[model samples]
Target: MDTLTNIRTFLTVVRAGSFSAAARTLDTVPSVITKRVDQLEHQLKVSLFTRTTRKLDLTEVGERYYPRFMTIIREIDDAFQDVTSSRHRIEEKLRIKCPTTMAIQYYGHILTDFQRSYPGIRLELLLIDRSVNPVEESFDIAIGALPTSYANVEDIPLCPLPRIIVASPTYLQEKGMPKHPSDLIHHDCLTFLAAGNRWQFQGDKGPVSVDVTARVSVNDSHVLMHAVENHLGIAIVASHIAEPSLRQGLATEILSHYPVPDLWVKALVPRNRRGNAAVEAVISWLKNASQPAPPWEQIPLSKITRQAPS
Candidate 1:
């Protein structure tokens, strides 16, 4: 057998955790798998696995080399696929992770449209609400509204996620409107867990931050908006989430003069996958979708305008 085949067999054995399992996966006998792994280890001059009758474990050297070997194989496979398929007909499977709220509110159609455009590409999407290590989790892409600084990962900014402070008309009517950030202390504020009680904004004087208390705190932006609509309290919500309510006159924007801080939507891609054709295509697609201005920003904020209290 060739060195490349032996190396592939060794990786399969490592992933399967046993010679028998690797054989089953490759449709061969355990002895063949064992011989292949042995050949690979001998060529490398290191014992790759610490083997036992019950289980198989990678040695220290094996653990260090595994990721490098995996990267090499991925690049080789991607190259073969690129050469064989037409430029626009690239076939690959992409594992993507995105925030649950964003996925529900925005990405449903966006992702479906991408699949339609690239029929040969298969998408496996996981909707999560927190930060995850894409490399460790084996995800091709991870999208979120927060900035990330991870080693061996590339952070690509997708768009700016502007926010607005809003409350139901009924709630504002009953509680009265606050002209300034300091006045938020008197109202029952609905806060997002990630943002906490302190809300930051920019105004004529300078940056202002208010340490307000919350009547109800939640992680989901959609839920927070729902609470605001139900007259729960005031909340700092994403512009997109609050748009519909403001347009319907169900909610009113407050502190319009004091703009809330904008969070950026970013895509986290592993360094090894940065050059991958499918990953590059998806990233390019996102950029194109968000360029000039995002879809949410396309609608005139003037349509739902509310004058700031003086």
Candidate 2:
């Protein structure tokens, strides 16, 4: 028996909790998985799992051995990555997580360009709206806006994404525009739940806050933008989310005199991943794409007639 392969199969089965699931992950048949596990058990002279119809449970020995095996596997994989990364060869798989709206609107081309530039690298991109702890989630990289301060991870600032108040022309026409931030209380606000229930603005005098009562409260910025476009109400959203509408003349900026606090587009990675070549390359590419003004701020509302890529 190939000890390494058998151990790998065993770990896979343990993680998957079934021979069938492990087989699917390993691209082998369930019987082959069972045989490998049986071989491993015979060699060790101990049963690793207590198998039952409903579930699989680890035996005492298995529980102790699992952590040791995990460390060995991780060290081996890291060794390979370290060697390849030193050569500047990004030939390994990379898992990335990002916001759904940003991924569709901005990163579609950036990712394509990166893939074309590095054909040996395989990419898996997962889109999510909520905050994610990259280390806890086992992601190689995470690209999104960090709403709050994060100290545990390394953050690379991509661009300034200031919030803007916008409303559809029809909605503004019907509801009338607010002259000041305080007047926003009278208008129906389409609010992003992530930004919280209050909107902040900096005017000539000082800062102002408006407690938002929403016509529609949503987590996704894109959904909130859609609601604004459909004349639901005025919304405070990221510049990128409002850009398409502002460009197409579908929505007009409100409270232009009051500037919102600047937000940012950021790239996050585990602290230990600072020197990772693949991740560094991605960060460099994203920084380049953001320079000379990012895609969101590049196109003037006057010139953009067609909708931006979804």
Candidate 3:
């Protein structure tokens, strides 16, 4: 990126005949222009311009390289404009990134739907817990659970990620049930402490955050779920996650009055390439994929019953 910026700077300075004039055009300081031109000269092993006390003149080498630089710059501009113009055109790679849990939980069907929607476009999905730069990594889009505020990245909420208080039927039966969020104090709350403990929620009275104490702490949701099923404690998890048990009557929803914050899944795209068609298609697809909420059977990932990988 700096290299490209430097090239443009050098070309501008040469065309303008002085660092001051170039700075005026580029809206940067004179020193910045000087460093960029100097760096560009050093990179090409030839001084691009001869600087004097009052006037600056392009060297013979500078004159020769100017056309080449302009040609390259023009090609880049044309290519970019062409790509931008083809916003509705199809038949290209649709690469996307997502968090592991989100990919399995939601996008499992979204991907299939995208493939079906755009058969000419090849879908490349990269799943990771850590967020990756879409532009830097050549990813077209991202579906992630965590929120980020990085430059050149923008987020659009895909769905509400409501966390729920879930404990397996066996566990709830043996240990009893929590009637309110505050009642978690008496239960063996099996939960992850990494994301924070104060589960803020909304009740009939308004919003409230309850500080929880966990008798059993586990990092992985899969493991924590086992502890929950075994009646080890109450586990607070996203609705999609506890869906299997909740629907099967294996797990029950607690504190329904104090609504959990909507845990949201977001689609992140390169800030610089927001309007690209390939990216736009996937973003639209992701938001619209689950027309009527998908059936759990359509997704094969284990929810509460997942032990160790088979």
RMSD of each: 20.1, 19.1, 17.5
TM-score of each: 0.64, 0.64, 0.56
Q: After superposition, how far is residue 216 of candidate 1 from its true place, in Å?
A: 1.8
lDDT of 3 at 268: 74
lDDT (10s digit) by residue, model 2, range 1-310:
8877888999999889899999999998999999998998999999999998998999999999899988998898999888656545667788888887777667766888788877677789998877778888988888888665456788888888878889999998898989998998898998776667788999898999889788899877777888888889988888766776788899998888998888788888888887877778788888998876975766443353445324
Give the range where candidate 1 is weakest over 10 consecutive residues by summed lDDT.
Answer: 301-310
Q: Model 1, which residues run further than 4 Å from truth?
A: 1-89, 297-310
Pull out the clashing pairs in model 2. none
For each candidate, the alpha-carbon lDDT, in order, equals: 0.85, 0.82, 0.72
Weakest 10 consecutive residues of candidate 2 by summed lDDT:
300-309
Candidate 1 matches the true fold with a TM-score of 0.64
Q: Clashing residue pairs, candidate 3?
A: 152-271, 161-263, 169-250
Alpha-carbon deviation at 150 in model 3, angstroms: 4.1
Better of 2 and 3 by lDDT: 2
Question: Candidate 3's residue-wise lDDT over 225-306, tens digit each?
Answer: 5566666778777666676666667678777887777756677787876887667777777766643443233454454244
